[model samples]
Target: MTSSQVFLSIALPFAIIPLVLFTSSKKIMGEFKIKTWVKWLAWIATVILVALNIYLILQTVGILK
Candidate 1:
């Protein structure tokens, strides 16, 4: 259970972070680039997810209890 949690928290963010970054990049996405508001929202969501993942890892390590 713990191993699964670690794997999911770590892997999920890696996948999502890149998606947000790439989509927000004008050079990479060209005419398909995301709007400023959407980019900000995506970044905010990404940061929250990452922070939650970090908290989860700390909890799993007995550092947050």
Candidate 2:
């Protein structure tokens, strides 16, 4: 991917984090709180996504050389 693509990939997840946090609230879930396992999975997924984005950035910048 190009620099713009790498940037967008990183930006999209950064943007989604706020949306996810917003949806996890009592306002969205009402009486249904987010489960521990689900939260853990989300955290893990976020970490992996971030790592991928960082790797993509490094690759695009030729830092992986």
Candidate 3:
């Protein structure tokens, strides 16, 4: 895979998943935990990123156009 694709599929998820989980975890962030709206937004973004990564994988595998 290309370097950019590798970064997006692997590195980006590694960074984003922890960021979303940590920011949303009250136990981790305490009073500084992300607000509800921001948490939802982050979750939505994470979902979109995951979807895009799946699409990229499919494309790389010739399952997608």
lDDT of 2 at 64: 91
TM-score of each: 0.87, 0.71, 0.81
Best by TM-score: 1
The 10 consecutive residues of candidate 1 with the worst lDDT sum are: 1-10
In order, the Cα lDDT scores of the candidates are 0.91, 0.76, 0.87
Across residues 1-65, which tens digit of lDDT does each residue of candidate 1 receive? 46987999989888998999999998999999999999999999999999999998889888997
Give a tens-digit lDDT track for model 3, residues 1-65. 78687566966788898999998899999999999999999989998998898888888878999
Q: Which stretches of candidate 2 lie over 4 Å from their true place?
A: none
**lDDT of candidate 2 over 1-65, digit per residue (tens):** 66689769769787767755765677777778577677778778877887888887888888995
**Comparing 2 and 3 on lDDT, the stronger one:** 3
Candidate 3: deviation at residue 16, Å?
Answer: 1.2
In candidate 2, the residue pairs with backbone N, CA or C atoms under 3 Å apart (3 or more residues apart, or in different chains) clash, namely: none
Worst 10 residues of 2 by lDDT: 16-25
Which TM-score value belongs to model 3? 0.81
User: Which residue pairs does candidate 1 place in steric collision?
Assistant: none
Which candidate, 1 or 3, would have the higher lDDT against the true structure? 1
